[model samples]
Target: MEFREAIKIALQSLWANKLRSVLTLLGVVIGVGSVIAVVTLVNGANVYVAEKIYRYGADVFTVSKQPRVISSYDEYRKFQKRKIIRLEDYQFVLEHCHRCQAVGALQSSTGKVVSGTHSTTDTDIRGWTASMPPMYNLNVILGRSFTPTEEEHNSHVAIIGTDIQDNVLGGNDPLGQEIRVDGVPYTVIGVGEKQGKSFGASQDNWVAVPITAYQRSYGTSKTITVYAKAGSTGEPLNAAVEEVRTLMRSERHNRPGEEDDFNLDTNDSFVGLWNQIAGGFEAVAVAIAGVSLVVGGIVIMNIMLVSVTERTREIGVRKALGAKRSDVMLQFLIESATLSLVGGVFGVIGGIGVAQGVTAALGFPSSLAVWSIFAGLFVATAVGLFFGVYPARKAAMLDPIVALRSEL
Candidate 1:
């Protein structure tokens, strides 16, 4: 029989037993849908994380007393014992780091802000040097950032986020308004551009003030973070990082073989950490989904074996009519493949739908890639073919005389 005719016949058989075919395809649908959903979510999350990491800029790096993430209490203790990164350290780097295009220092804490009776429940309060505007991408949407003189003089001027402006200050002319942060009044000299949200959390829920002023108001107990950008990206950034590292190590009196008592983090470091987390999630999710595919293939094989049994008389008739064994095998194999391929098609659609549904409900990002679709279909078809072989072989090997004698 011709391949097209075999496919037509196989489809008709599937349609005739619609309920059974539907049940058989369920596993494949679930497996493919899960795989696609995970891939979409992971892809979107990777992009989101990368964007967040590079929010300040690609060339920017931060030097802090502790690493970005501490996995254990022992590690935290070790970091706590390290020398604190202070304003003096920041100044040293600012004055001497030639490869650096800009340098800044920042420290932050959470506090409540009040404007008359209107008040924020909580907001991030940051103290920044004048150089932070350029290094930190602190885009001032209203008025302007505080000048070097203001930072030097410890002026009580502030830059407020949209949350502080709209929620605490009533969103009128936020610039020049006075808001008290933890009972300390500051004149809003600037309003930062609105940063919408991330993972359902508001990004625009913070305020920035001069480092000098913050130190006096909040006390100088907490460690400060130093920010810097290379004169250029790529190689220059590496050169800048090394120059700073060498200077910091020498200043801290670290012996030649001893490690520096500080952490240097860039956008790529954050992205790499995210990738490690994402990779593990992908592996676990895909493994669970693979089980479904295996089960689906088993279900298809069982259905095909039953099909061969039911069509025993028909197979006998075909053999008596001079149908070659190869022809019979081909027909059964095609039927099995068609079943799997059809399931794969539906599975791809269902996977995309699942991804979209999750993204919509949770506010988690999702971006479907074209390759995932093709991959789903390919896996489905392979499963069908592998499982169909035994049934196809059994059908092809049936004895005409015995098969004819048997009744269904």
Candidate 2:
């Protein structure tokens, strides 16, 4: 028989027992769907992290007193004993680091903001130098950022985020109005554009003030995070980091061969951390999906074997009519593959719909990649071929005389 004829026969068999075919395909559907869903969700989260969490542009990094990833309680305690990064260190970097394009200092505290009866607690009060705005791409939608003189004089001027404007100021014209932050009054100089949530927390629930003013109000004991922008060259970022490290080590009086007492984190560092987390999730998902696929394949193999048994008379008739063994095997193989491919198509659709629904309901991100769909279909088809071999071979080896003698 021709290949097309075999395919038609296989499809006809499936259509004749539609319920059984559907039941057999369930495992494949579930397996493929799980894989696709996981990939889509992971891809979307990676994109979100890159765009929102790492929004400070690629060329910038921050210097802080402690490492973001502390391996143990002892390590955390050791880092806690390190000297806090200060505004003076930021200035030193600006003056001494030639590979740095810009350097800024930031200190933040949580407190209550009050404007008459309207007040909000747990509000982030960030103090930043002039260079912070440019380095962070902090666009002001209303009014303007603080002037150099204002920063130098420790002026009580502030830039409020959209949350502060809406919740405290009631969306009124906020510029030039005074809002008390922890009992200290600050005239509003600007309102920052709305920045969406990161890691399920709102980014807009904060206010920015000059570092000088913040130090005066909130005290200078708080550790300052220093942001540095590297020069526009491939080698400058590493060079700048190295230069800053050397300068910091020398300034802190760290003897040669002693470990530095600060952490330098770049955009890639955060991305790397996210990748590690995401990779673990992906691995677990894939493993679970693999189990489902194995179970589904077993179902297909058992069903195919039963199918061969039920259609013994038909196989015998074909053999009596001069059908070759290869032809019989090919027909069964085609039937198994077609069954799996159909399931794969449905699985892909279901996975995408599920991903979208999850994203909409939970506000989690999901992005379906084309390759994932194709890969899912391919895996399903491969499972069919791999599991169908034994059943197809057994059917092909049946004796025409005995098969015809046997009754279903």
Candidate 3:
């Protein structure tokens, strides 16, 4: 028999048993769908994470009360026990770190803000020096930032975030308006440019004021957070970090091997931590998806075995009509493969829909890569071939006379 004829027969057989074929494909559908969903989510999360990291700039590093990433709850608890980053340390880095392009100190706390007839329930209030805007690459959309002299004098003038502008300032211009912070009134000297969001945070909606003002008004203490922007080239970042470390050690008057009081962090360190988390999630998802695929493959194998048994007399008829054993095997294999491929096609579409729906509903980024689709399809086809081989072989190896004699 011609290969085309054998394929037609195989397809007709599958179509005739629609319910069985559908059931047999379910495992494949589930497996492929799961794989696609996971890959989409992971890819999306990676893109989001990368964007968030790059926002901080490659040349930027920070020294604060704690490191950027912590692996475990125990480690986080240990970090919480560490001393806060102090104003003196920030001053030391600014004065001594030559490799650093700029250094700034900041502190933040949540407080209520009131203006006229309106009030905000709670808002993030940050205190920083004149160097902060440049280090963080923040641009003022309107008005001017507080000057270095204002920081020195602990001026009460403030910069309002976008959200605050809409809430407190209303339709009126925010610049030169007075807003109350924790009951103290301050003039809004500037409005920050909309910086969008990253890492699930609204970077645009954060208010910045003078560090000295923050300390005195809120009793924020001398503890501060410091970020350093390294030079544009070479290992300046590393050198800058070392310089900050040495300077801090000398300022604190620490001896050799003594634990440093403050922590330093970088974007690379945060990325590494994020990957470790993503990797664990991927492993778990793969394991669960693997189980579904295995179940689907077993179903395919069982269905194929049943097909072989049901077609015993038909097989005999074909063999007697000059169909070779190889032809018999090829036909069965093709039938199984066709069923799996059909399942995979539907599965890919379903998975993509599911991923898209999730992204839309949850406001999460979910990207479907070309490679994921290819991988899903390839696996589905492979499952059909792998699981169908045994049943196909069994059908092919049967004696024509014995097959003809079988009652089914």
Candidate 4:
């Protein structure tokens, strides 16, 4: 029989029992959908972090007391023992590192910001040095960043985020406006450009003040995050980092055999850590999806076996009419594969839909790879073929006279 003719008959047979075919497809659909949804979410999150979350420029790196991504309790405990990176540390790098182009220090905490009756809680409060604005990509859309002299004088000036402007200040002209941060008053000098949302949380709900003012208010015991940018992005950046590392080691009193006392994190390091976390999620997703696919394949195989039993007399009649054994086998295989392929198509669509729904609900982006869809379909078809072999063989080997006499 022609291959096309066999496929047509297979599809027609499946269509004749619509309810049964659909019931058999549920497992495959669920399995493929889960995998695709996970892939989409993971990929989207990775992209979002790389492009938006990790805003440190190629030549920029940060110095902190601990690494950004801590994986274990032991590591956390170890990091807790490191000495806090302080303003003097920032000054050390600024004054000593010839390879460095710019250096800045920042300290942060969460606090309440108030403007008359309007107030917001859990708002980010940052105390930054004068040069941090450009290094960290913070732009003042209105008014201007505080001058270096202001930073040196411990001026009580603030740069507010759009969220503070809209929610706390009630959309009033924020420039030159007075707002209270944790009960300490600061004049708003500029409104920092809006940063939108990250994973459903507002990124622009923050205010920045001079580092010296922040130290006076919040005290100097708290650690600070320092940033440094190499003038160039290439090999000079490495030399600059090494220079900072050497100075930091000496200042922290680290011996020649000891590890550095502080952490230096770049955009690439952050992304790499994030990817490690995402890789674990992907592995778990694949394992879970694998189980669903296996169950689905088993269900298809059982259904195919029943189909072979029901079509015994049909097979006998075809054999009696000179139908080859291979023809009978091919038709049954095609029917089984068609069942799974259709389920796979539905699964792919449902996965994308679920991913989109989650992205909309959670504010995480959705990214679909074209290859994933094709891979899902191919896997489904392969599962069908693998499981269909037994039933196809059974049907193909049936004795013509005995099959014709059977009641089923």
Candidate 5:
């Protein structure tokens, strides 16, 4: 028999039991769709996190009391509750690290700011060093950054954010103007340009002041975040982190083989941490999808078994009319494969749609690779072929005369 005739027979058989075919396809549809959605969500989160980190600059690394990416709430709480990185450590890095372009410390607070008739509530205020402007890629729009003298002497000068300038100063020249921060007055010496968004929040809306001034005003502790920008492109960030670790370890008086008190964060480790989180989710998704495929395989096997029992007389008639056993096997196998391929296509479409929807809703981006889609389809077809073999062989091995005499 021609291959076309086998395909036609398979289609006819499937059409005769449309409800069973549709029911069987449901497993594939659900499995593929769920896998797509999970992978898409994970990919979106990865993109969002990677962009946020890149925005911080490739040459920069930060050091704090704990690792950059904490895996659990308990770990976060432990870091917050512990005192590891200190002002003395920041000063040590500032003085000793030569390969660094600049070292700066950051102290953050949220408070109210009042300017003339306008006021902002619950605003962000970052206190750092004069060197921070260059280290973090911060650019001045209309005025200069705080001078080193200002940071050293705890000067009352401040830099106003774009949002503060727009809403409070009415877009006028804000230089040398007084703004009350939590009722403490400070003179604005510069205005930062609009920085747009970072990690979903407006970066331009925050205020900046000298670390000393912030500490004096807010009663902030000596502890602050220390950031260092490496000098060379090929400079090893991990080595830099190690250098910082060594300096910190020596200062903190730790014995050899003892874990250092402070935490170091670099780009490579940060990305690895993100991958660790994403990898967990991917594993779960693969397992669930595998289960779905197994269920679909069982359904296919059951349907094929029923088909073999029903087509006994037809198989006998075909054999009597010169059809070979291999021909009979191929026809049944092709039918099962065709059903799985169709279901797989529908599942792929559904999965992609889900992925797109997740990306849109979560404010993250996702890219679907061609290999993933093709993989889903190929696996589905292969599953059908695998599950169809037993039934196909059973039908092919039947004696022609015995099959013809059997009751339908």
Candidate 6:
């Protein structure tokens, strides 16, 4: 028999037992669907993290009093023992780091901002140096940044985030308007561009002010985080980090051979942390999906065995009419593969719908990769071929005389 004839026979056989075929395909459907859905979510999360959390420009690194990732209470206590980063340390790095093109400092606090009867609660208020806007890509969409003189004299000028403008000021022209932040009045000199959402939370819910002004209002006791940018045409980021580290260690009076008390983080560090987290999730998801596929393959094998037994007389008739063993084997293999392929097609559609539903319901971003769909289909087909082999061989090896005499 030709391969096409075998395929036609296989399809006819499946069609004749439609309910059984559907039942046998349940495993493949679930396995492929789960794999595709998990992959889509993980891929989308990676993209979101890269664009939002790790959006710092190349050649920039931040210096702070403690590590960003602390695993235990002991570690947290150790970090707490480290001296708080002071404004003098920021000034020292600015004057001493020749490889750096720009240096800035930031201190953050949370407070309520009131504009007339409107107010925003628990809004982030950042105190930053004049160079912070360019260093951190904090673009101004309306009005102008406060002048250096304003920063020097602790001027009560403020830059509001998009959320503050829309929620607290009711979308009015906030430029030159006075808003009270934690009871201190500040003139809105600029409005920052919208930063969208991250991790299901709004990023544009804050106000920015000069670090000097922040100190006057919020006090000088807050820990400062220093930012430095490498020169465009000069030293590499590693060299710049090391330079800052050496300067900080000296200023903090760290003895030689002792571990430095501060932490330095770059954009790559954030990416690495995200990779560690995302990698773990991917591994667990794949393991669960693998179990489902394996169970589905077992079911297909059992069902195919039953199918061969029930069709013994039909097989005997086909062999009596000159059907070769290879022809019989090929026909069974095609049936198994067709079943799995059908299941895979349904699984892909289901997975896409699930991903979309999750994104819409939770407001989380999800992106489907075309390669994941193709990979899922291919794996499902392979599972069918692998599990179908034993049943197909048994059917091909059956004795024609015995099979013809057997009951249906």
Off by over 4 Å in 1: 9-15
* lDDT of candidate 1 over 290-345, digit per residue (tens): 99999999999999999999999999999999999999998888888889989999
**Separate clash counts for every candidate:** 0, 0, 0, 0, 0, 0
**In candidate 2, what are the lDDT values of residues 66-113, reduced to their tens digit?**
966776999988999999888888888878988888888889989999
After superposition of all CA atoms, the RMSD between model 4 and the true structure is 2.1
For model 5, residues 1-408, the per-residue Cα lDDT tens digits are 566776776677668778987898888777776776677667767877776676657777887777766778998887777565666778898899866777888888898889889988768988888888667567788788989899999998888789899887787889988898888888988887786654345667778899888888876564678888776445466567678778878877878997666677766678788899789979888798979987988898888888889889999999999988998888888888877877788888998898777555544466676777887888888988999899889888989999899897
Clashing residue pairs, backbone N/CA/C < 3 A, model 4:
none
lDDT, each prediction: 0.89, 0.88, 0.82, 0.89, 0.80, 0.88
Q: Which candidate is the best by TM-score?
A: 4
Model 3 alpha-carbon drift over 4 Å, by segment: 1-19, 171-173, 193-204, 405-408
Q: What's the lDDT for candidate 4?
A: 0.89
Clashing pairs in 1: none
Candidate 1: residue 13 lDDT (0-100):
83
**RMSD per prediction, one decimal?**
2.5, 2.6, 3.0, 2.1, 4.4, 2.3
Tell me how far candidate 1 lies from the true structure as C-alpha RMSD in angstroms: 2.5
Candidate 5, residue 209: Cα displacement in angstroms equals 4.4
Candidate 2 regions with alpha-carbon error over 4 angstroms? 1-22
Instruction: Report the alpha-carbon TM-score of model 6 versus the true structure.
Output: 0.92
Rank by lDDT, highest first: 4, 1, 2, 6, 3, 5
Ranking by TM-score: 4, 6, 1, 2, 3, 5
lDDT of 6 at 401: 91
What is the Å distance of residue 281 in model 2 from its true position? 3.2
In the predicted model 2, the residue pairs found to clash are none
Across residues 188-209, which tens digit of lDDT does each residue of candidate 4 receive?
A: 9899888777687888999999
